[model samples]
Target: MAFSKLELFHSLILVLSVVSVQALTWTTTPFNPPAIPLAVRSPYLSAWLAQGAGAALNDVWPTFWTGSVVGWAGFVKVDGKAYSFLGAPNVPGAAFTKATQKSSQFTSTQSIFVLSAGPIDLTITFISPVEPTDLVKQSTPFAYMAVSAASTDGSPHSVQVYSDISAEWVSGDNSLTANWSTTTGNVLTHQVQLATQAVFTENNDHIQYGSAFYSTTNTVGATYQTGADVTVRAQFINNGRLPNTQDTNFRAVSNNWPVFGLAHDLGSVTSSTAPVVFSVGHLRDPAIKYIVAGGATQARSSYFWSQFSSPAALITSFLGDYANALSRARAFDSKVNIDASKISADYASVVALSIRQAMGATEITISKNSDGSFNKNDIIMFMKEISSDGNVNTVDVIFPAWPVLLYTNPALGKYLLEGLFRYQATGQYPNKWSVHDLGSSYPNALGHNDGRDEAMPVEESGNMIIMALSYAQKTGDNSHLTQYSALLDQWTQFLIEDSLIPANQISTDYFAGSLANQTNLAIKGIIGIKAMSQIAQRLGDTSKSANYSSIAASYVSQWQTLAASSSGKHVTLSYGNSASWGLTYNLYADKLLKLNLFPASVYEMQTAWYKTVAQPFGIPLDTRHTYTKSDWEIWTAGIVTDTATRDLFISSVKKWASDGLSTQPFGDWYETTNGQPEGFRARPVVGGHLALLVL
Candidate 1:
């Protein structure tokens, strides 16, 4: 396969960009990311700056992951001259000049952009804290944007910073009537929401029930306003401050375009000036509707509700903790970078870019009491299988995302798996194999009581057992396994029957279409049986352990012969097809769990074979397509023993991260040949990028 002229041009640009930025000290290398995450905290609170052409911050409006505009705009008034620093189609009559973006870099939890506005240099940092262990801080739906300005000419400049959120942030539909008001206390909050709330529903991935909060500390020189976008922005643009007035006439989002604005009047700005910080978030009570054991629905509140009395309290604490949060986030970035760089610099870039998107898809929730308080003890971290399907707690999805969860905090891996186990333990899913996902749609964990969920019998069963053991292995806690022993046993029994040669069924790569005797699927089932043996051993069931071990070993021997190609070079995609070949990423679980189900030669063979089939961006998912799943590619990379082969996989993905054509969030699925996004984006499966880190 020859590289297209466009691909060659992107490659040249990638090389030049790296060369040009080498002299500048940055937390991470500057790359043209598919999209720059702005305030991506939860599914509903997610927003990003789509990177296209020059990838300039001021060129386009920030959009929700679904590509709808979520009107977040920022401007800096330097000596009464307004300049748009964040979003585009500059507010009319503001006479806004687009700020020149100097550089852009993203750490694990923050995206930093440096821009020039006249004599002042503005550093805008978007911080979405990733507190994996601290449920309280992590559960807070808020994300922060801090703008610090200093005179590049070494002279003091009077500067006033302004920012706003339009009513478009409230609901996806622009025609919906938006009701908004201002709350003034220690903090000034402009709250906007749909006039008629549609609870437990969504429009274009925007939750229709929540209130969007745009807030800042109520400082002496601060003012607020709620009115038409042009009216409020022009007010600040001309007077260097807002009117501090609220628009009482609630109207449609498209009607004059209502906006919530805040302005900070920094009299004299120099390097010594304090940074202006803003907090933006969405508040959704009864976050998830979950079904308990008795088929009764229960509303779950965000875990932050347990710590903070109300939305105000949570927002206040989050706003005040910016310094500490930024410190922690920087430390996390350093640790991840240093650790991942030990593998390769290319590998570090891949891991660094994926951390936020991987963790952002989740929400930590707890059951609420009758009096509206949350039950902190009964917590579950629910994941929205974003982009592809909005299913809550998808097993295969969790399997791919488990590496980061396990590496960050093993308890999180347990928390993710707990929801799946709890749902199945209720005897609602009548399938002998593991259920595909908790719910058909997100925020609704109503079990498939009718047992009509999509079936991936061998695939999901293997994922559950592997993830269950991986969590227990990392945390040294087998309590979950012991607690869900019966279900595990049932799934293992199903695997035992299907382990040797899988019947015609879909694997996790269901997009590739179904095939009988899939080589990768068979191996997963075989490894799952081995994992169940370990579980039985941990439980002191010596007879059960021996039985499973013998079955798994016998099945592996048969799988090796049947799945291997006639040339004995690499495994085929399915049994008995010499021309068929695929990623065989399932092999990573065997190595990860220390199962040693396959010999050393098998790893060496696959590693060598991958190099031959590698494309410019990545190895293809299979012979059927030119595309590949980034998560699976990383997993395959982690299983290889040789450094060259591992680096080959890592660098290819890093190249794609920098050059991929899709102007959305980081996509997990893309064309291996041209780095164009095929389908999926912003999915937690990018957590699989941490496979090398996990190793």
Candidate 2:
């Protein structure tokens, strides 16, 4: 719709009135992501900032991670002139140009957005209660959505801002019947619960079947819902008039939008200063909590409410450490940015934006034992990148995901391995030599998804051995490896025997169909054996280490001979096939493990040959197809130390990240000829983008 002249005129006046130095403190960047992460807190309770051509905050929506609408809208009343500042909603005379939205900074634990609203400024912060060392907080589902306001006009203005949450948060749709209750604590609270209390009814990324609470906190006013939307109204009046206050803060069930909102009744502000924080949270029931957190849900739930408001406090203690948080996050971002800047700006943006999603993709939880003590049994699973399979804890997914965790904290790296180790210890997987695709589909993470046809048999065993050795090298502790030492020995021996020259088994790139004597698969097994030898050395088994080391060295020499043909510039996709070539990306593992098993000629030949096969989006997964996995391309790019070649691969990823046709977060698989998403959006394998950091 065209903007009316008077509406545009009023918007100009409002912007001109804003004179505070604190307005728009965040720096702007050239690349704007499809969505900015907001409450990137946990598995079920995460949100993102939406942007449009107008670039106004009001016109944008706060969508769930899956790009579903959470039914949230925000409005502010300035001296009785109501205006929409958040979410897309129709209001008479409120059609001002959207405010500029910016994310000043972000980390795995926190993200901040500032909106330059017409006459006032609003700061929105999303923080997970993560302390790096505290697994409990990292696993906790409670997140803080804190909003504060200040007068940018340098004149007193009565500002009341509120956000209405949609009922879809309860059952992935607003059509579900909802009952609302009003709780009058120190802060005004509206809580929505589904009349039907079914939980975990389905296992998928879409929030289609679970029930949860949708609440907005703050203000005192009548809370009710119209047939169209669940609504909560908090009015801030000027010049001695106040909005009507309801008698009993507690009320009965009514079908509304299942909405809750907070009222920031700022009487008036003349100078530029940070106002009090008004916040809200999304809480779920206790059954699923016990499954993941166990016995600790009661305390965590109580803490979630206490964080909203207290004497002289309106935000979580996390907000109190804002300065420290920003400083640390900036430092972390700067280090990544420094190297990222080494590449072209296009590639730099992809790395910066993609890394955050990688960090947020895994769902973690700490469990309490039967003895009433807490154990950091974090069951970290990377969601299959929009594969629609909803495969949980896939071995190949974990392989690409470990680089990012290893960079941040090796403990988190171990977190991924412990789950697999636990599964093997149960003997739940019948295969004595290999494992299944996933423990189970997402959310139904009970045991291996035994029903699906198996892929990545030899692929998974090799991945686990390398993972255990890589983690041990970083942390210098292999006790976890020792617990599953029998499994490791069995797997490594399998690689030694059949995996070297084996039957056509499904590999990581199973989508391309099974290839016989796949050269890349050989690279994986070679590294796996080398890693086991390294582990043996660390475990003080010098004789075992020496024997395995000699075997791996002999295999490496044979690999060079078997993989190459007796012709000019040989580039074969598999051993002796001579049809096409795939990347020996796994060869980087030699240097990563500090083992000089491979010759320099190996990397030089592959890196030089990769250029001949480059396509628009990236080099294909192999020469067999035009579709590509972005993560493997990055690993292949790591084959050389040259800056220019690495940027070539990363620039392709930049195109993939901003592809208009794709959804939120990112996709690992895409068409190489053009930047269209093929599959795998919002998966943890994007963590492989951080591969360069470890190198």
Candidate 3:
């Protein structure tokens, strides 16, 4: 059916109406909303400063000391009552530094550091004190360089500072410089790149990555107070890399630099015993080192803001502009596989709707082919980074959206397919299925390294194959499928043979502990096989297509025989007779990841089960946990044809999105009920946030 502007506008209104009503409303102390930087759109854009893991929005405080350090925590204020809690932990000084390092179970860690302090003491700060602006920003004094390395000249060979921002690098006694760049509209980018540096060192010059939040009570004239409800937590980089344990050697002096004109000589002391000193030395070897942080750095933010922010804003600035751009995009090549109307809506809706989630994440570029023919292919999505220098290719991170791109822009869909297919085609893996991820988050695509327990190979392969076919179907083009035939065949072969799928193995949903009889895994396998057959048939390979088609049809029979439930819902866990199969089973069965195998009645039953499992924020993935997968909930919503059911799922997504603006940026996953973002922001999974448009 040809979609008219009226029809498109109607869908837009429906999405906006449901979202505006169901989403949580956090009024600034004076009932005004926070000042959201118009540029960013991601999971974090929703609720600006609420740090609770659940959706209970509370006030936070940014504790800036007059000395060389700052801290943040949660604060609650009632008419006659007052409360304070450590809302988030950025750099926690232990007993080794705090009380007794032995008594701590630092399951979580994050940090922000100052790489090169200016002549004056440098300060960094954040806020969330329930003011007109959800998160308030400030500057705090630069403090302790927790980890450092020295050189022969007593310069900073390398150093690691634990402050509001993180930095690791090797510096000589030479002049330390800062890099500052900016663009209008992106407030997040404005703060990140202001007074930032771009020195590439292994340890000392690297920026530390963590979450920074604070609170405030707004006064009448756009002024706010340093309130009690602020908090800051440092996020540690757990990229599976081996940890280092070396004593720090900080830079002690600079003979020629003016900043050292009258510098005090505190001497070469290891502990924080010195009053103050100028330290300079390479922290570690300058050759082939990674001064890693938890997030994006200045340069990275600039690149992303230029590419994503400007274009997004142009679309939203005017309705005619949006329609014209969409028309131009479609006119660029009629052969593009997605519907123009759908893409238009997606572009419009994401900005109007999901802008907050997009802003809180990071974006980076990778070099693929030297000629740059595939420049678009090199655009990598970096989740939340400790600083602005992080990349976005991680394993379990692929869980965001299978169809988000399919609905918005087919080119993006092509980009996703190219990334996955290119990784698998690199001959990096021996198995027929693909590996978990290309590498750690926020860097280049290092070869897959999750090893055996890292990724559900079969699960990802099936997902890729199915998604490819869906893209082809939506675009009405069989070119992409035809081009990647060999890879698809290999994946299908793996499914039929090795994918008996051990009970204890990991599935794409990494957090769900290993399950023996994972019905969802079985469903994914069935759908994948069918997709492959369809792809083969479209490519005109009848015999090969029929071979897989026959297998898939037979598997369907077996699946029905094995997965049927007595209660009319899909069967729960396959093996654990004692396992409680709740909404996830049916949602997987009925909604999410359109295998196109189930009939309408079957989907109806599945949606019914989801209704039973529905929590305030969303439908639960299973009875095992109340927290839900936000993207998956939207994916599941795609299965039903009923407008009400679709609206329900869309409303749930808006609820999470509303929380996202103020929370964290475009997280891959989050807690279901309270809408707290879980792990990995700006990761690729947020692509799933676009699932509804495809429907």
- Would you list the C-alpha lDDT of every candidate in the order shown? 0.87, 0.60, 0.38
> What TM-score does model 2 achieve against the real structure?
0.81
lDDT of 2 by residue, 44-107 (tens): 5656665311233455677766677766666666666555556776433233345555444444
**lDDT of candidate 3 at residue 373, scale 0 to 100:** 29
Q: What is the lDDT of residue 533 in candidate 3?
A: 82
Reference-based TM-score of each model: 0.96, 0.81, 0.53
| Best-performing candidate as measured by TM-score | 1
The local distance difference test score of model 1 is: 0.87
Better candidate by TM-score, 2 or 3: 2
Candidate 1 ranges beyond 4 A from true positions: 1-28, 369-372
Candidate 1 per-residue C-alpha lDDT over 1-695 given as tens digits, one digit per residue, 9 for 90 to 100: 89854456446646844753453333234466788888988988888988743466777899998899988888889987889888885566668788888888887898899889999989999999999989988888889999999898888899999999999988979999989989999999999999999888988778889899999999988999999888988888888898889999999999999999999998887674677899999999889998888898888888888887777888888899999999999999999999998997777877888888889899998986778666778879999999999999998898999999988998888888888899889898889999999898888999898888888999999999999998888878999989999999999999988867889999888898988989889889999999999999999999999999999989988888898899999999888899989998999999899999888888889998987888878799999899999899899988998877787777778777777367879998889877788888889999999998887
Across residues 1-695, which tens digit of lDDT does each residue of candidate 3 receive?
89753345346545644554345332211011112121122212212232222222112322111011112222211111222222233223211111100110000010111111211111111111111111110001011112221222333221121212211111221234322121222111111111223332212212222111211111111111111111111111111111211112222212111110001112232322211111111111111111122221222221222232342232222222223323342342232223322434323233222322332332223332444222433433334322222433333343344444454445444544555566566565556676655444333344443344265766777767776777777677776687778888888887786443434567756576777666667767767777788888788888988888788778766666555676656556553343455433223422343445655666676666665555656666766677666566666666654655555665555555544333343343556667665554434454555555555
Write the number of the candidate with greater lDDT, choosing between 1 and 2: 1
Q: Weakest 10 consecutive residues, lDDT, candidate 1?
A: 20-29
